[model samples]
Target: MLTLLLLIPIAAEHKPLLLERFRVIDAPDPATRAAAIATRADEIDLVLTNGTVGFKADEIAALPRLRLLAALGVGHENLDLAAARARGVAVCNGAGTNDDCVADHALALLLASVRALPQQGAALRAGIWRDALPLFPHFNRRRLGIIGLGAIGQKIARRAAAFGMVIGYHNRQPRADAGEAVYFDSVARLAAWADDLVVATPGGAATRHIVNAEVLTALGSGGHVVNVARGSCVDTAALAAALRDGRIAGAALDVYESEPRPPAELVGLDNVILTPHVAGWSPQSIEASVMNFVANVEALARGEPLPTPL
Candidate 1:
């Protein structure tokens, strides 16, 4: 028998069968998370955490029997990889499990921001016709630039093409499948060329603050921006300042630097839309992610390499 602490609640509806083999810990707070680990240190053979709230090196050292660290999603940005590697503990993530859900949310945010749907809805609820208020813009034939041509970005591009938007992207190396879309060598150049910019990059020190004040300013006053990736990919302070001074026309975000809590600077901005970091969440995706974790765990127990080791 093994003891495992789940950092966040998984989909209860899926009825994970591994429950009988492990003890589940629901730790939503720092104190509670640490407390659970401390109390069950010796018995915890596995630790379950989302990509964002990863297990620390010291935390790993505390648990003598920790054999695996299973991340709930593709991102393991906050994970202590070097420490885990040094300890010889296997690290696995739910790769490709939630990409579709996140891509769907990204497109939804992009459409809403560009069409000014929220503002339009609010005006209608206040008994003012759209004609009386400022008209919301259309997205037809607009140039949509995507940053980072990864799996999620590719999915977004496919969906955007259906809406009649011209697609372009910036990446480290040009993807052969990206033949349908134009490729830009630099992010700043891509922003200048696009009427709207979508960010789908990974997070970490390498990509931190890639989208700064200069990039936002280059997007210009009539340009829209959508971020469905990591919050650190774009500087929040720069984004908030851009919205304030009309450096960019509008912005939509589903992830932030400080999650579960919305940014204080963006709270009152009508031109910006904010959501809790739930871009990768959906009924189907949640179920698949849990199943993926279970499969990885089973593989680890059998001394086989994980199907999707991160």
Candidate 2:
């Protein structure tokens, strides 16, 4: 039987299927993670981890027989891609598995920020009348700019159309399939041109801090920013400064610089909307993600191509 190192948390319903297929060794918890991983290092043929709970290089070094490394989510930033490549390990991720969930969450954040939902709720609870609070920007008919035009961003655009919003995007190259949507070659230019900026790019060194003070400045005081991508893509300190100085109107973020902990700088700010890094998490999404993992490993066993190779 093929041995597997299950680093990412597997749901109860899916656990039995995976356990039955392979000699699964669980090491997700802190207490058992290191020793468990070490004990089975040489025997593990495949390792499963997530972007945040990424498998390390030293851990990779330990697993001499490791044939595959898969991230349960779209991001595999924490995984040492170079090292994996050097060792001829194939990498894969649950790319399209949770696109809808993440897109829906991004829309929720944007609408909440645009409508001042939190502030409105706070005022109502504090006994303030509706007209006493300042008016919020209308979400409909506004210009929406997405940083990445990948699978999730396309879904976000599809949702945005229902609100009668005009869409623009920034990417390395213009996509012909984007149809009527305008494209910006640079993120800064996109921010300047857009009324609201949405980040949908992946996390990693290439994208780290791509949305910095300069981009925020270009976004102007009337523009709002939304990040549904990795926290590292945006500079937290720069974002905080921009919000505090009113350089940007507002921000809605599902991910931040610190994983597992809220961004300390933005948590106290009224102009920003914060959520736990659950933009891609849902019961349905998780099920789909696990299914993707199962398909990848099973394909590996059959000597066939995986569904979503990273």
Candidate 3:
């Protein structure tokens, strides 16, 4: 049986499924991870991690026999792809498994941010009526720009269709099948054309801070921004500055620069909405992701195509 290191946290209910297949070790915290790998590196053949709990280069060096690295979520920004390639380790991720869940959350953030739902709800609780509150924009019939035109971005576009929002996207290259959604070569250009911009891009050095102050400036005071991708993709300081100066109308995010911790710079902003990095987390998505991990592991063992390799 292959020995697998479980670096990503799993729901207690899902633990038994993986444990039955491989000799498993749960090392979810950073404190225990290095020590666990150090002690069992020779025995570990496969590793399960996520974008946040990424397998590092040093960690890869420790595992002399490591053959596979699977990211439990869609984003694997933290995973060292180059290191994996050097070691001839197969790399896979739970890509399409969580698309719907993340797309749903992106739309939720977009609607909430545009309508100022959370703000108004709080005001109502504080005894203020609708008549006393400032007016907010309607979510529908506006231009929507997606920063990435991947599976999740496409799903978000389909959802936004009901709201009559015109969709556009910015990818490294224009997609031939993007259909009616306009395409842009630059993120800032996409932001300029959009009334609301939703960032669904991958994280990592190539895309880090892809949505910086320039993009925010192009988004303008009438624009709202939502991020459902990796926090590293957006500059937290730039976002905070934009909100402070009204460079953009408002912003919503499920992921920020601070992972497992809230971005302190944004805590005081009334024009912003924040959620824990849970855009792709739901009981359904978690279950799907776990199954995807199992499938990849099984395929690796059998020399078959991986179910989802990124």
On TM-score, the leading prediction is 3
- Mind giving the per-residue lDDT tens digits that candidate 2 earns over 1-310? 8888888777798788788878998888766779876576778898889988887777788888999899999988888888888888888999899999999999999998888898888889999998788877786779999999999999999999889899999888999899889999898988888889889998888999989999999989888888999999899999999999999989999998896788999988998999888899888999889889889988877899989897
Task: Report residue 304 deviation for candidate 1 (angstroms).
Answer: 2.1
TM-score of each: 0.95, 0.95, 0.96
Model 3 poorest ten-residue lDDT run: 133-142
**Cα-based lDDT at residue 65, candidate 3:** 89
Ranking by TM-score, best first? 3, 1, 2
Segments in model 2 whose C-alpha atoms lie over 4 Å from true places: 29-31
Task: Tell me the tens digit of each residue's lDDT in model 3 across 13-78.
Answer: 888889888999879888788789878888999999998878888888889989899999887878
Question: lDDT of candidate 3 vs native?
Answer: 0.90
Show model 1 residue runs off by greater than 4 Å.
15-18
TM-score winner between candidates 1 and 3: 3
Report how far residue 163 has shifted in candidate 1, in Å.
0.8
lDDT of 1 at 113: 91
- For every candidate in turn, the CA RMSD to the true structure comes to 1.5, 1.6, 1.4
